[model samples]
Target: MRSAAMRDEPRVTDAEARRIAFAAFVGTALEWYDYFLYGTAASIVFNRLYFVSGDPVVATLAAFASFAVGFVARPIGAVIFGHVGDRRGRRASLIITVTMIGVVTALIGLLPDFAAIGVAAPILLTLLRVFQGIAVGGEWGGAVTLAVEHAPPERRGRYAALPQVGSPIGTLLSSGAFALVSLLPADAFDSWGWRLPFLAAIPLLFVALYLRRRIEESPLFTELLQQQERSSSPVVEVLRRSFGRVLVGLSASLLGVGGFYLLTTFAISYGTETLHLPRSLMLGATLVAAVVEIAILLAFGRLAERWGPGNVCVVGGVASALVAFPVFWLIDTKNPALVVLAITAGVACLSVPYAVAGSLLTELFPPQLRYSGVSIAFNLGGVVSGFVPFAATAVLAASGKQSWSVALLLVGLSVLTALGGAIGERLRIEDDVSAA
Candidate 1:
């Protein structure tokens, strides 16, 4: 079935490349579905499930603290998995990371109630989250980089965007599950039904793995391997040489992704409690935003191709900064239509930089150190943003200023993200293929 030109084309056939991209999409989707599902649960379910505290604010902060633990663990996971990925190959790294995520998530579903385990339950839950963070920490950089490196230069934006597309796909699936489950009685759902969403991810991971196995090492990575040009210490080499890029990349992702987790992840709570909106209404807002997020992500990739990712990000950040305050004010209005419009607008503006994050970091380093650099930025960004919800809550509690606080915070971060993107554009070149 091979074409004459394909005889010397690459390690993978054209059909195989498509197969790999699909696999990467599916795997990334399943991982984020599980990952973000926990965030959704932490925002809604964890306060009741883990903490018996009568105080809503205390419980909310505790749930967020637990959520933050997952992001904290991601950097460590990146370090361990980054080494394996660079020293080994993208294929082996994914196999291990996916396996870990699949097992931990399913087990999270099976975990005993706080009442049954007493103090041990939340402690155990935090530990499991740590592992989940670690698994995904290593998984993303490898997944996106593999797809991007294997793709042709002209198609790189769309190809890289393929795995990036998985974020919204995953968000859609996970958020949809929570939406469906919300239809159940609150007591019943809290007691047992919430586990179903987490348990649901196992089958998806298996399918992702099968598809991913068909992909070979990237041609660029293969050339590096064949030449034996890998770094003596990839982590060190990346740190010593690429540290500035990593810092910039990490800072860029922090505002958008962190802002996202705060808005989508923590805002779920904000809408329900602080704003006193319905769970379905807030989730509906997230679903709307997610749809727009997908559209924005897809089109923006083409836009980035035409205008460069930096300019696209600048436009996005400016939009986020300018509109954030009014958007938050509208959401707190308790007017359903207005709230929906605000949510959609807020996330769409934020999606600009986030949509391009994987590609930005992926293109920053050489093949061997790419994994290290990307993983560091990704994990660190999560850590920074992961704490945003808790910090937002505490700040709001102290200042009694939920609306303006969130708006100004998100807008400020967006401006910072745009600044980072501008810096990256000026300083770095797109990684070109080296002579084999």
Candidate 2:
């Protein structure tokens, strides 16, 4: 019933819709930049700096465990900020989330290493990661809701996908920053060069805040407010009424979140440590893959409008599954060109579903509960995804550093995503009929 009312809400001007999409893009990109910075650092620097252990493998695992810590806090952030978005407003929730992430990211930069402070160093780092997780848990849902709600119903696919581009943009920026710094002498790189990217978060935060401040509130959310139709407890309402949808949403979200870490974070670790490839080679591969992902996202956004977001996701998932083994095979060659091609192909294939996940997830719930619903489902998927790199790393180690085990993990995630897309398509069809 609420979906019907949302469809009837006045559409914003094209210029207004574009402006909102752009604003959402900027804020999301910055949030992801901060988030991905941590991931990249965990792979390249944190293990050595913070997670000092007798075994190199033990140190790497500990660093990734800290990386996973942020995922644990994501769902908590989702519930907290989801309530704020569904009640107070999307704008308010976004402002707070971005600020929290920026501050936490900058603090992570200044944090002392184990040599400087002992066990307390890692404990403090883990605490800051928790805050980062919380902030980002709220970020994606609100950004998508704000963009999609402001757009014409028929064009929501395009607008919704705009914010999704932030992932690759974030990947590109964070990886590019590290790639530049990785050029420093090994001792210098470890000492202070690594801190530069995290510290860069401070200025980027201000730019994001400025853009977010100027954007208009979501039109659909505004109507909910005027009608006094806001749910008193949106998180509970969503779960009680739409638990199944939430589950499907989580499935739909897995590849975009989990598959991403597999291709980038874990892959970087594998390439650098196991293959004895240069760190620059891994970082450069990631940068190239990110660029490819951005193009794929924009292209698939348009495709989602034509094919339906869910259907596009299904196709993407299938494609990712097909490419999974080949991606690993290429990386196993250990040739720089083949390795770059492997990462780019893997990232590009997975990006198709990721490109449309925002629109698909948005359509799964009504406007009144949209923020909470999307946040809970997506972040729940993130909770699982957070462990993906750690899991992939562990699997690789257990398999005697065989790349195929990690490839199989990607295949499994891809199939799950396909199933979610199929279910989501059925739900979307049912929704269209019900609205009619």
Candidate 3:
């Protein structure tokens, strides 16, 4: 065993904490931007280009199926990259994930559509989507672990929330880009404008890699390395010893992941295809919601400081459940202002649970199994929730385009989030009582 003296590295300075947090924020934002841009394209562009069919709805379904394929690859990434993160270092794993995501996203820009490559176009696109999923599957746990581990103990909530900010930041950029490209004459936008956003990943890749390289490994991970206490099989260890924790973590994430995709991805399609709303209106509404969510997330981070993450998230989760039907009601009105309000309300409800999820998950697992444990739970939830768009789309189609069916699904997920969070809290209390 390493000497206690050797393990006692100085705590990270505030300046260094900010630097680490900023790098995490930037890298995660770019990854989400790349990942979410695909969802945006799926709703508006890919269905028309990659999957040509006589029926537009059938073509759109095919595209969503392809979109969901990415989720299937996430667990694979969690195992591969989680091992590296658990044994090697957080910085190394992050560098690899960011690079993989960036390259794949840029490559997507070069892919030929159906006209050029026939059936191969979508097949290739699905392959790239798998890579994207793997890259991101490995990303969230590493980012959260890095931020939380480097932070002062009392400030972990706020620090961990920094990475969560990346989601909305990414959404804002993705929606803004799509909205801009959407301005082109429909033919021009369809032909080439959609490619611009995907191609933009090239420069972002360099920036994220450059910033990530400048940061040190997590101090906690470095300590584990010095002690030579790394688990031989971190993922297996997590499953064998702490699977309940894993389930709780996954449960906590359902609403944020599921509800988020529904609002941003499926809502875009619903607005355009079913409601007969303009494409720009849907994109613009999404952009506004993204902007509002950023502030709400930051506020909740501060709220977590006083109220605790569990309490704040529980309240947020329940409130989200209550408002689910009303949110869809607003969207059904078809007024631009009401539509924006609907999306904004749905996303805002998500901010509370999302803000605390990083710190909460980090706390649930010990440092040795932290990377593997969080990665499995987070990515597993991602895989399950990844189908939200596809599932919501199918439900809408089956209901003959009734918005109520989708709303009910959203409410059900919110209830699950509340129950999952409560279970986690109960488990934590039981653990504390046992220790006492």
Candidate 4:
């Protein structure tokens, strides 16, 4: 009953699995570093440097709006790179995506400020952000797919979670870089210190490409190629055959992607502007939170082996919802210790679902279209997540700076994540039955 192509494919040894997983981790870390760097800058630097306005609030909103432009480009990136990943190979798509992000990010560092170039500065910045968004849109899905597909079925969850680790690592590195630079005097920081983090992306990119080039193509994808089973139009095929799965994956991904922005980006702005906390305090909180999330992700990856990734997601969602208000309360207190504790707890709770999202999403569609399916769903969720900071900022302003309204927003996102997990589990069961 087994096809020759499937049988002929080499089994993934534990060593090979680890190798691929490490490569995925490195690649994704680079991707997220570029992404999170922009986010950190948008909150603290870009509003002043690029989107200068008379009113601080107006300038911040404008900067965040430019940040949201990348999210809009994400779905487009998903479709384009997803097609390449699905039709060509995951390796090729990743190389292209990583290279694109590295170049664009470095360019941003060298870009002229608003004072130097007037409107052209912000316009170019937004364009670069769009390219960054597109590159990232493709990066995660391919990285996760390559890692998961290269592992044995029993180890898929652990390997899949490896790529997810890159997120917190990215957060850690980006936050740390910004934190270091934030130590500069105001005039110096506003002038040139902020560009260091973005410029650092160039070296990091080379390291990522080296690791990625060393890894082999996914065996599952190789099998597809050998069988001549690759879809000519993976995007169209996925949309037609598994549109519902895409919706489910989008919901499952909300808290990890969207809630992350709520907790970090928006919270950073909230801490600084409303509570009058120092920039160092907010960045420091994020650094601590990222460390906590790394541990939580590793632990949960193992837990997913026994409890199932879906179940873990459901639990994480509920826990995040319960802690949403508490997180805000702790931040509102303005005590540095409590603020760090609050962000750490929030990131830890939400990370439970995020840790295993890669494996869960990969299972949502067949290998033939896995790239497109995962990319579309995940990036579509990103599309919304990208705007979360802007929306939260707007909501907070409109509600007279009430933290409770923002908490309510987090609660709603958490609930949707839970619902998606439940639905995904049921669908997996149905799929198993059909296979049996």
Candidate 5:
């Protein structure tokens, strides 16, 4: 069944590539579903049920801060999981991270509301969120490395992008779940409806674990083992040899990571509270946007193969900055269709940079240190991006609820990513020359 051109492809068989892609894509999707479900719950359920503040806005802010608390723990997770991933094997790290995320997420479902457990409710929720943060912080580097390292050199761009596709899939599943549950009568929804989505993580966890187990370890990592070239301390090694590139990678990722939460998480609060949009309408718009995002990400992933990932990402970064103001303008109109248009525009701009990020960043470090380098850079970026919802909310309050303030934040972030992408392009060239 192989094409004439594919017959000469190097390093990996088509069948093995397909298997690696499926395992990475599906496993990351399940983990992200668990992570994003918390964001959805933060906007709707957690503020009311866990925080229990006298003022609605105050409760919302507190809930968002709790969400940020998860990011605060990510670097720690990255170090712990990154070391394990680099030293032991990608398969073992994945097993631990996925299990941690699934268990924490399901426990969140079982947690009592403020009325039942009082202060203990919010405290326990924050702790569980921290565990979720650690698990996911460690999850991405291993997942992407497995896919990228298993791929043929020529197809690395496309294969690496396969894992990036997981974000939209996760968003779609989480938002779709919320949208369906948003249908219950207000009191019923407030009581137990939200828990259903969290509890649903159990089955997804099993499937993802099963898929991950069936896959082989990264061929590149296997080669490292055969050569007896594994780093004694990958975290330390990456920092020693590639710290600057790691910082550049984190900067490049800011727009995709932070701006996404700004649009989705902060936008949800803005839509419901300030614009008076129905929760269903907002969730529905996001659901549609998630679908739009998947298409855009897939298209961009393919485009990266032709255009070059850095060139494509540069285009995306600049475009995101340009579109920021108009997208917010559409949202301000409060029409459901316009809101969908606004979010779709945001996703369109963001997807290009995101689709190629795994491949682009993967090239920055040598294989022995790749897992650690990527993990540290990415989780640190998460630490920064993780605060977007909290910071955007404060900025909105300070600016008298003007959406432009948030739009401006997006513009600033997009510009940083563009500059970082340009720098990364230069670094990538240097890496290529050195490897050559």
Candidate 6:
């Protein structure tokens, strides 16, 4: 067993690093594909298809509320999976978490809707979401650690960034998938269109599992195993050692991910509700935003390689804060040109901070507690911030602030995100094995 103070030993080969990186990308992509498919269904179709309630609005909110339930479950899931990763191995945790997501998501597709089975339909869907959150809670830490620990010390930012970028890829795929499915006749869409996307997850998960099994465990994890340095209880150790960083991580994440949940998950409802925009127009904007996110993410990944992940995130924060007002302005105008530009800018800014963040956050702790730390911190952030859209919706319902409302309301959040990024950037925690 290695002690908390064991000296770092570098054993990562370039070939090994490349292999792990690909595995990280594929694994994360499939994991997210499963999750995003559900997010899409919940936001758009699930309320209509799954819920027995006649009130579409209530049903939609119920669906999203169930979505929020998953976020709430994230912390507990993180604790459980972190324990497994810490006590067992990252490879095992990775396979388990990813497979959990795939099976649960596919089950949602296979489930009968309200028309077929009544209340049981929505009940089954909610159950699937709970499973998904638990699976995803464990996902971020394992995937990020796999790539980050195997990366060259100097290139940790870029290596870690690869897995995180899969988010944009997943969002794009999910958005694009549903958009395509939406083209079916309204009758068809209500009946079977939604099931296609959900069932599609099966093959994707199969591919992810195949790639994941072939890859060896992270060298850093193996080192921890060899040294007997794994934590007995990662959650407890993290609470004891990193309580402050955990708080900071949660705060930083609120604006970044909260903003994300708002932009994507909430945007679907927002487009239909606030803007009275057609599904096609809003979807096109979403697709464009996804494409834009790819470039911004890759750029930040490169920037993190040069300036450290935190520093790159800081720059992203500053840009996001400054762009919030302009983004709102364009979104409000309903100009196709403006809408495209606005959504693009918003996603680009959000992607920058997020791209570097997964790595930066994971690197903050030591290898032994790394998986738990990252999972707990990130999912807890979700619990706090994941419900912003629903909260915003509630606020709007009460305030009746429809004139330039949502666009204006979300500006402060952008600034908050930027500040958190700036603070994180300044504190460049070294990735070397931390105190156990």
What would the TM-scores of all predictions be? 0.94, 0.99, 0.96, 0.97, 0.96, 0.93
lDDT for position 7 in model 5: 28
Judge candidate 5 against the unseen true structure and give its global Cα lDDT, from 0 to 1: 0.86
Better of 1 and 3 by lDDT: 3
Residue 122 in model 2: shift from native, Å?
Answer: 0.7
Give one clash count per candidate, in the order shown.
0, 0, 0, 0, 0, 4
Q: Write the per-residue lDDT of candidate 1 for residues 1-436, one digit (tens) a residue.
A: 1112212334545465566777788888888898988889888888888865789999889988999999999998888888887888888898888888988999889888688888788898989999999998898888887877676655667667778778888889999999999999988898888989999878877876776676677776666677686666878877888888888888778766787886798778888988778999999888988899888887887677777666667787888888888888888788999888988888888888877776677767767688888898778878888898888888778778567887777877888888878776655443332212
State the lDDT of candidate 3 residue by residue for 181-300, as single tens digits. Answer: 888998899788899999999999999999999988998888888878788999998889889888888888888888899998999999998898999999998888888888888888
Off by over 4 Å in 6: 1-7, 52-56, 401-405, 426-436
Sorted on TM-score, highest at the top, how do the candidates line up?
2, 4, 5, 3, 1, 6
Better of 4 and 6 by TM-score: 4
Question: Candidate 5's error at 183, in angstroms?
Answer: 0.7
Off by over 4 Å in 1: 1-18, 429-436
**What lDDT does each candidate get?**
0.80, 0.92, 0.87, 0.91, 0.86, 0.76
Which candidate achieves the best TM-score against the true structure?
Answer: 2
Point out the worst 10-residue segment of candidate 3 by lDDT.
1-10
Task: Compose the digit string of candidate 4's lDDT tens values, residues 200-317.
Answer: 9899989988988887888888889987988899899889988999999999999998999899998998899788999999999999999999999889988887877889899999
> What would the TM-score be for candidate 3 when compared with the true structure?
0.96
Model 5: residue 190 alpha-carbon error in angstroms = 1.1
Q: Write the per-residue lDDT of candidate 6 for residues 1-436, one digit (tens) a residue.
A: 2234334646687677877987888889878877877767776788677764767667767878888878888887899889988788888998898888888888888888888888888787788788888998898878887787788766767777788778778887888888999999999988888888788888988898899898787777777788777777888989998887776566566655777777777777766767777877777787898787777776787688787776666666667777766776776787777877887778788788788877677656667887888889888988866577677666656667452455555566665556656656554443232332
What is the model-wide C-alpha lDDT for candidate 1? 0.80
Can you give the lDDT of residue 307 in candidate 3? 73
Stretches of model 4 off by over 4 angstroms after superposition: 1-10
- Cα miss at 130, model 3 (Å)? 0.2
Which parts of model 2 have CA positions greater than 4 angstroms off? none
